[model samples]
Target: MNKFAALCLILCAAPANAHPHIFINAGLVFVVDADNRLTHVQVTWEYDELYSLLVTEDMGIDADYDGVLSEADTARLTGFDMQWIEGYNGDLVGTLAGQNLTLSAPTAPTATLTEGKIVTTHLRAVSGAPQINGTLSFLPYDGTYYTAYDVTLPVLVQGGNGCEVTVDTPDIKGALSMTKAEIGALPEDFDMEAAGLGDIGRRFATDVRVTCAAL
Candidate 1:
């Protein structure tokens, strides 16, 4: 099975109380043109140490288990996480003025091992280069709640003068309460594979909003 399918199976099979298996610290850099149009978003993801270790071992990297990668190993690891199954959206949702924005597939991918963790970055172009006079927002999440993302890193609005970036964290207590209630209502023999819960992680996501002042 493809990586996405395998991830879904593993996550969907877990009990609702179980936490996300993979953790990522994510950041974004919004690239805008002189006309205040958003051209692309540079996204960064730093994998948790445990997940990084698993990936290295699975790929037979770092043969000596020294927690350090040689130049050849680093080259081999580049873009390792950029492989996306069809229609996977890269777990990032972008919107402008409450309307969904089309984002191109990840490009300019780069990856490195830092302190025994995998740090990767990629660029996603905005399909239309939409002008951002209003609000542009992004939410990083795994709909299955299998991978948790925390916007704990820098978020910048590059090349957009007077643009403000804000990150809003969700209400964890309330979200957890609602999620528990919904899961509790499921039938005893309900099949998650047949009918999956929709975007549960959306409730717990961190909102990254950018607003640019009119020239």
Candidate 2:
């Protein structure tokens, strides 16, 4: 199922001069094993009320028309984990020791409607997770900027000791403005691949880094 399209039903609402039709408040919790190797990332995405309303109407969440999410409502929406499609990496990119970490299918996925908002949580296993030594960083963003992820929670380092985590919200205002200008200047028939602006979304991401002292 195309979760992105499902979440974004009102495509025409997107501004013509910019992207992000929907807004999400995201939180991340880093999971590590006893050996201090990164194992998984627990992600919580709280969607805006408007998109949540769309989900309830379109995804059959409020099946009973009760205006409340029940166990059955959440059960029906289980396994709604967004999948990588058409070169889209679900807007989350992780790296360990400067090497990209491959992400597996999300596990323990769940969804609920609370206070007129849709909240989803899942665990993304870190395939080939490196032993934590210096840094583990992640960049979350949508390539087309269809959804803006605002990560508000502090990165939690769990099941590991002597580790320090810091979040760097890089100043991307200049770079992103430049990228938008470049994209706007492109000819209608120009190929983005030829222009090499394909990962332009990364310029607007918040960088989360984890560093630990010697174990």
Candidate 3:
């Protein structure tokens, strides 16, 4: 929790050499027909883009989603999302089908954890028309490459209805845990003029992806 607060303070300052930790909240609604199959998804990942210092650098270390895992990479994850989180031109790999989604290393966003590797937190899937809000970070690595995602998403979680998870195993890497008041109470200087964050933190949902998930 203290770390989360510190992150907010640093972001409010927008220091140098810091990665942009941002939340490009997308409203994802998985649609299915009478049968269980992925039909459509309403994605809106571009909302109230802010200067998340962490989002800028942490997600950039491994342009490749292979998760061999790296200690050095974890160190670099610090002080990220404090500046300007940029945008990219890529898409998440996993597929979502009728109340369920699939995640795998060989697929799009299984998240292997090596220098460029990822991990399989292993949990995916949800119940009918679940309301989803996620973030995307534009992170570049080795000073020239980049990637994006909602590091917040977990592998396995209690079904939104509080039932034990049967399928859709969730991976909890980098999925921070905090309370709503804790996050909202974190110190921040939402002055787009002072922080120079453009339209950030101005109109609630219009600027950042909030309100829905936490409620």
Candidate 4:
């Protein structure tokens, strides 16, 4: 084709030529203290995608996607560890009761973009308000009957623009450990509401507001 036609083709093929999947709900953020150590993270997910993976074709914790996980699903999830979690949090708060993650952060935070550049990101949220089921928890020994506390809370989350986070799956042999990142920078195709290859655990933030709480 002519020069102009060839240029048009290049632009048209750009979007698909890069990323593999059509991400819907995915995002990433990095919180570094004065010491440069990575702090906490906030992730929000696409219910449909999550349900499809954990649950079945629209069936996981809440098998029917009716806002509430099935009794059997909840029962089976007890004390079970979720493998291959990329941005998985350690402190859980909403489990053992078979309900949506209700992580209510006592406080929020105010945000400020540091550098004038695109901060690569890969982030998401697991549980928040308007959600009815599917959450993680912590198991503690009571010296008799163990107790699980749900830590799926919505703390004040912050992020920068022009950021992207990505997953680097090394082709090394042995145990293929999933080492996905959502901090220290932005992602390759970080759109805040879209997921890409191998970022199945990535959740995007919804109604992302970084205002200080009035508490």
Go through the candidates in order and give the C-alpha RMSD of each one to the true structure: 3.7, 4.7, 16.0, 19.8
Clashing pairs in 1: none
**TM-score for each model:** 0.88, 0.83, 0.24, 0.24
lDDT of 2 by residue, 1-215 (tens): 24233222322223334445788888888888777888889888888999888878887778676667777777877666565456556678988789889877677888877788888888888886667886889887776555777788556888776777888775555755566566556565665557875555567688888876667
| Candidate 1: regions farther than 4 A off | 1-18, 189-196
lDDT of candidate model 4 versus the reference:
0.28
Measured by C-alpha RMSD in angstroms, how accurate is candidate 4?
19.8
Best by lDDT: 1
Give one clash count per candidate, in the order shown.
0, 0, 57, 46
Worst 10 residues of 2 by lDDT: 3-12
CA lDDT for candidate 3:
0.29
Off by over 4 Å in 4: 1-24, 34-36, 40-42, 47-54, 57-65, 70-82, 85-215
Write model 3 residue lDDT over 1-215, tens digit each, in one string.
34444445533334333333443333333333333232333332331223322332456653443433366655554323222234421233322222223222211122223232222211123223334332211111111101123323222222232112122212212211222223355345434344333322211221111111322
What is the TM-score (0 to 1) of candidate 3?
0.24
Clashes of 3: 57
lDDT of 4 at 181: 28
lDDT of 1 by residue, 1-215 (tens): 54344434443354544467799999999999888999999999999999999999999899897878889898889899988999999999999999999999999988888888899999999998999978899999998777889999899988977889989998866766666665556664555555455566787799999998897
- Predict model 2's lDDT versus the native: 0.72
